[model samples]
Target: MIKLLTSADAMLYREIRLEALAAHPEAYSSTLAREQGKPLAWFEERLTTSDVFGAYCAQELVGVAGFRRVDGAKTEHKAVLWGIYVRPQARKSGTGRRLADAVAAHAATRVEQLQLAVVSENEAALRLYAAVGFVEYGREVKALKQDGRYYDEILMALHFGGQGS
Candidate 1:
């Protein structure tokens, strides 16, 4: 099952987030070293502020995705999709797709466009976003640097028909 996560699910969310960071450090902007020191209350605040969704298997959170609308008036029509991850055991089980679908559905209701960035070498993630109707709009060189190596990122976006559509 997939559903929006609340502050009550903070501990589970934190666990999965740390796992994602550790398991695939190249895929995310945040480092495990930085997040490890954060308090549980920080995670709870994140859950309360962002439109975070989780995929659960019999009460265990296995996947997560976050959506957040831009803050400024000029950018309010845009939203960002981020922190998408599914457990290795949960991959190929449609958990990622379901979590993404939930985020997209929610974004379509609130913004005219949904945007995300994927590491250029992550073919699986690129394919998944493409399958969800996100089209590549640009690429950023050296978007992330880890362990003395640089990784580029592909920027993608999906446009919804605006507020009334």
Candidate 2:
């Protein structure tokens, strides 16, 4: 099942976030150690956001994605999509697609463009994002650094007028 999350869903959110960080340390720029110190209030606020969505399998949280409404006065119609991650065992099992679909469905209602960045090395994610109608807009060289190594990032966007399914 795919659904919007609430602050009350903190436990599930924390569990899934930890799993993602542990399983794909290279895929995400953030590390579990960094997030462990964050206050619960941070995640609580996220749970209450109008744009956060989650995907579950038999009631187990399997994936999560969120679209943050643009803050600039002139960019309200756009939203930056982020925090997209799926459990290792859940990859390619439709969990990622369902999570993305839920976000896209909500974006269709308010956003003109949905933008996100993916590490250049994550081919599976790139393919999945493309399958969902996101097209690469540009690439940033040495956009991310971790453990003394830098990684490129690909910026992608899905316009509301394009096919997304």
Candidate 3:
């Protein structure tokens, strides 16, 4: 089920986050071991955030996606999607789509646009974003640094002007 994540779900968040980091180091900025050192309070705070959303299956946390609400008095109408990850076994199912849909729906309530940065090399994620109506606006070179290497990212955005159906 897709629902807002609570502080009580911090352990599950940590578990799935580490799994994502370990399984796909090239997909994220933080390493598995690096995130493992984070204190429980960190996850607790994250789960309690107003912008965070998560998906659970059979009582097990399988996916998570969230964003920081845009700041500034005028820019509060936008949010950038981040920390999106789903278990390998859960891909290709409706979980990813559901999570994306939930995020978009949630964003629409507070923002006029939903934005996310996807690594150019992550074709699966690129396709998923496109399938959900996130058109590519442009590319940012060397958008992330990992292991002393640079990774380019595609900047995609989905405008909420009668797009959601």
Candidate 4:
């Protein structure tokens, strides 16, 4: 099952978020050390600010995806799909695709485009985003650096083509 998350789900969200940042450090720009020090209230505020979706299995939150609209006037028509992750045990269960679709569908209601950046070497993530209609428009070479190494990122976006105002 999938549902929009709220401040009430802060604790669970924090746990999963920390897991994602730690286990897949290469996939995210944030460091586990940075978020680990944040208070629970921060997570609560995040839930209230960003549209976060959770996928559950028997009441356990196994996956999460976040959406945030751009703030500038020129960028107001765009929203970003961020912080997407599914637990290892939940892999191959269609949870990631479900979360992606949910985010895409929700974004379509409020923005003309939904954008995301994925590490270029992550084939699974590339395929997942492609399956959901996100087309790559560019690639930033060495976009991210960690521990003296760099990784490229693919810039992708799904355009709603006036379906969203």
All predictions: root-mean-square deviation over Cα? Answer: 1.7, 2.8, 2.7, 1.6
The residue ranges of model 1 lying beyond 4 angstroms of the native Cα positions read 163-165
lDDT of each: 0.94, 0.83, 0.84, 0.96
State the lDDT of candidate 2 residue by residue for 1-165, as single tens digits: 888889988878877877777777766778989877778877787677746788888888888998888888887877887889987778779888888878887888887888888999989889989999999999999887877888899999888964342
lDDT of 3: 0.84
| Worst window of 10 by summed lDDT in candidate 1 | 156-165
Q: Provide TM-scores for the models.
A: 0.97, 0.91, 0.90, 0.97
How accurate locally is residue 6 in candidate 4, as Cα lDDT from 0 to 100? Answer: 99
Q: By the lDDT metric, which is better: model 1 or model 2? A: 1
Instruction: Evaluate residue 15 in candidate 4 and report its C-alpha lDDT on the 0 to 100 scale.
Output: 100
**Residue 11: error of model 4 in Å?**
0.2
Q: Predictions ranked by lDDT, top down?
A: 4, 1, 3, 2
> Model 1 residue 149 lDDT?
96
Q: What lDDT is reached at residue 60 by model 4?
A: 98
